[model samples]
Target chain A: MTRQALPPGTLDDTDRQLLNLLQEPLPLTAHPFAAAAAATGLAEDEAVARVARLREVGAITRFGPFLDAAAMGGAFCLCAMAVPPGRFDEVVTLVNAHPEVAHNYERQHRLNMWFVLACERPEGIARTAARIGKETGLKVHLFPKLKEFFIGFRVVA
Target chain B: MKLDATDRRLLAATASGLPLTLRPFAEVGTWLGLPEAEVIARFAALQAAGIVRRIAVAPNHYAVGMVANGMSVWDVADEAAEDLGARIGALGFVSHCYLRPRSLPDWPYNLFAMIHGTSRDEVEAKRQQVAAILGPALRASDILYSTRILKKTGMRLVEGG
Candidate 1:
């Protein structure tokens, strides 16, 4: 399907409702769409259509289950790097290719490049790093999350 | 998003972590002193209101062997940022990507993309690749490595007694 281009900052109430729903899905139930439609005061078809539209517009990145890797005995850490002026996209592409890499972001700092990699075990993290290094030819500074005080947040629009 | 009492109760129960069981909601309902159906209903409402983003597991990267992680910030040309941001978002390594209003005199970066790696060295290498793609148009960029994680929890939709 040809993707429709979204206008800048063009979001209606239904669009907002869709974005909000994608962030946190309700418990999977027999009538999930019906439940959501009731809550949003829209028809079930409208609720479903809104979500699909959001995905099409690129507003909602991914709508899926959030897993607790820690509970599954997986190891993860937050790391960052300082990239020169001219290689952000190339580096991002290389880093994103790794399966273990889960969450990546750009923050305000000298060590500008940052991402999180979650692996089956703690040892696998190092190997993933080495592979990324080999692929990109840049020194990756491994900053394992030493302590986790808190980890989840939601932005209400 | 204004949450009702039912919404509040549901959020309070599932905010930290989901019950790992076959009947998770039933278990959660028992803990919260509510009926399973009610808990389920409110949860659905909370999600629709945009109050509860997702009920999912937060992975421990360290435990999984992803020892290194970082927040990669970029200074892309204002004109090209939306396009570049979309491309970065599509990358698997990038979990979160957004365009924040640049903080003048404090933070100059307008676009941010996060990438995760097992080791710090690995993340650094990824950064170089991103830099190459950005080319000469980027004005400045930085990586704020997480020294400590203060708090991570779902928003409390209900008020206290």
Candidate 2:
């Protein structure tokens, strides 16, 4: 079925329901959409459409399962860089190309560029950082997470 | 999303990492002593409730060689913050972007974007790109570099101490 295009900030009750669903997807099941619709009191088609619209509008980045790298014996670290004027885009492209890098961001500060990297092994993280520093010709600060305080929080809006 | 005991157990077990096996779900089911079908069913319920987000693999930037990272906070004009944020989010380098209410007396930046790079220079380059896009409207910004690795895990829906 063709879904109606979503208007800006025009989230209805159904839309909200869909958002709630996307926030937490059920286990991989045969009829996942149907299961979600049953819980949200919406039709399967409506649930699917709403999810699609939400993703299209960027409210939801993706609809998939989460992975635990540590469990897989992979290592990860959080790092940041200080970007000078007129060079942030070029740097980001370089960083994103690496297979280990997962998420990157632009923040407000001297150390303005931040990203997280996951590696097959723990030692690989530092090696990759050194490579980045050499390749980019800049000081890349490696901030390996020391102690995890708060893991993940959700916005209940 | 409202969660039951079984769902809670599933989340707690899988929050950190899924079992590294051919049938990860089957392994989880074995641990929980439930049938695979039941385990799968509860997971669906949790998702429908909006308690579980996406289930996808996140690349470890520090592993594959791209290493620079930062938490960029921007003091964007109230009127244009959302527009600029959406634009920044569209950038491939940016993984997560959101609008947060600035804290009083300490934090004035309402928009946050994450950028990653292979090196400090690379990240700086991306920062410049974002700055150019915002032009002069961006008053100030800060990049808080992570100092140490900490606990990263998925949220547990069931209430527990």
Candidate 3:
């Protein structure tokens, strides 16, 4: 199922190394790229340029502080809805109308539609879910994570 | 750590991204009228409080050929959920692992691990690894393949300004 998107030589060894390395926690120092460069045996300028190029090519989505909304008195909730196939488009329109919805994906399941709601306050999750329910006339199941297991997660780049 | 007005300003400024420069922190500071040292200090403090998970890179799996993203959910025994969850999360291929509430008859999976691969078969293979890790504790499992993206407007800053 792997479709070769780029040429075989598109991503060099250094590029792959940086991609994997950058996934780990970055230093909080003023010159983070400088630190990264030193660790990866690259010049600071080159590291910056290569990262920028990766971003330009959409090989990476973002590189910055990953904030936990819950720590900032905010909340992120995973929500799902089993929308009828015929009303799927209309329901999506109504659900996506709320600014709280970060992203919505249609999945293969009876409870097909899944999305995440990032809210400033925890209460906002319930409020937005209720509003979406009323608007779409569908039951929205909120699966706010009860516990998150910290993983040594590394994206396959 | 409670976020003050200045902190919120800093967050809102860098929410989109941290400027990619030799002195990226200083560049972010310039936007919020803070010195580089103070910006660094505040971030350090916030990070200590677990507010900032990390400063890192996020690879777009889709763009990198790991386009097959599967939400492989497992119904593990409740008593052993947390223990098994930790094991599942530690897998190199598992991106996110969360122990969530099972919605009874409708849904019985409590352990959710996001598995990504170059193809669905690869994803399935990874899922099998997870199931194997789960072993007898795994009662049932299923994977939901995303059919489409209904919307992708990205996250927003809540109204507080």
Candidate 4:
């Protein structure tokens, strides 16, 4: 079984149901929240308010449409770099400043700094990695997805 | 679907998030000066065309305390990689599984799976289960646990549009 920890918040049964419902594809209608309200047995106003509260408290990172970059003629790749310990902070700032860098993380490995680079250009991943390497003076390793077996995330609420 | 200027504008308006209101589509329409019905229709069309994967909430995994994230890389036979990948991807514990190009003479793994758990031990156990599934087909594998999230945000097409 997958291990999971309850999110921090004063949540009740209603909130848990709401979280699960929110992960679903919302109805695209004139009154979409109404559908959510119906599912959660809460008023439309209350449902919207609760979602807003969840976001404010950082329980929900984002609530909206998830766009597919590849389908939209964009490029993306996972990259890693081994930055010197002394220059880690400076390199992080430089890497994050680039709009092309989607997300980055520090991992427990020799090649520590890992990030996602995404852009509309077909060769954007390579170009961005090259630029990051030149700018940070660290060797950037590109790990682009050759094939997708699965791509989805769901947390048991 | 080919998104024109108007479609781009609409997506730009809600790229960060949908307006927190009873009628988010209508609100977006108001912001873009387009009819509410038109906005709703276009949004639906975008989804049908697969440009928009879905309208949903992305929960904060860390905030939820499922902090352990292990990027498991495996060296599987090139011929059987696809079949094994499909099986691994179907596992409930594997949040993301993909076949990534590996750099030869250095990085030798190709199959990658992003597994999440509440702790390192949990993630390691999950990795073992994945190995058990792979059996002898798994030549080699390694898990890289993320220590910190330096930056995180979804891909954006337009810059603050």
Chain A TM-scores in order: 0.61, 0.67, 0.84, 0.77
Model 2 chain B poorest 10 in a row by lDDT: B149-158
Candidate 2, A1-157: lDDT as tens digits: 1112234465666666555554453447544566667888877777667666655454554344553334324677767678775887788778777777777766556666767777767888999898888878877776554222122323222
> What lDDT does candidate 3 reach at residue A140?
86
Give one digit per residue, the lDDT tens place, for model 4 in B1-161.
78888888888888888988888888888898999999988988999999898998987776666778799999998988999899889886688898988877568899999888878899899899989888888899899987787987767674321
Off by over 4 Å in 4: A1-9, A84-99, A134-138, B158-161
lDDT of 2 at A15: 61
Q: Model 1, DockQ value?
A: 0.05
TM-score of chain B of 2: 0.79
Model 1, stretches more than 4 Å misplaced?
A1-27, A30-157, B132-137, B147-161
Q: Fill in the DockQ of model 4.
A: 0.54
Q: B43-130 in candidate 2: lDDT tens per residue?
A: 6665555454455323333432345676666888988877777788777677667676665444577777777776768878888898
lDDT by residue for model 3 (A23-141), tens: 98888776787766887799999999999888877777787888776676768999999999999888888988888899999999999999999888889999999999988888888
| Each model's fraction of native contacts | 0.06, 0.09, 0.79, 0.74
On TM-score, the stronger of 1 and 2 is 2
Q: Give per-residue CA lDDT, model 1, range B1-161, as digits (tens).
A: 45556655565555555543445676777887877787677666655654454553333234323556676777789887776776666565566676666545445777666667767798898778777777876788877676533223321222442
How many angstroms is residue B63 displaced in model 2 relative to the true structure, after the best TM-score fit?
0.6
**Looking at model 3 chain A, which ten-residue stretch has the lowest summed lDDT?**
A1-10
- Residue-level lDDT of model 3, residues B30-65, one tens digit each, is 888889999999888888989788888888777677
Residue A19 in model 2: shift from native, Å?
Answer: 27
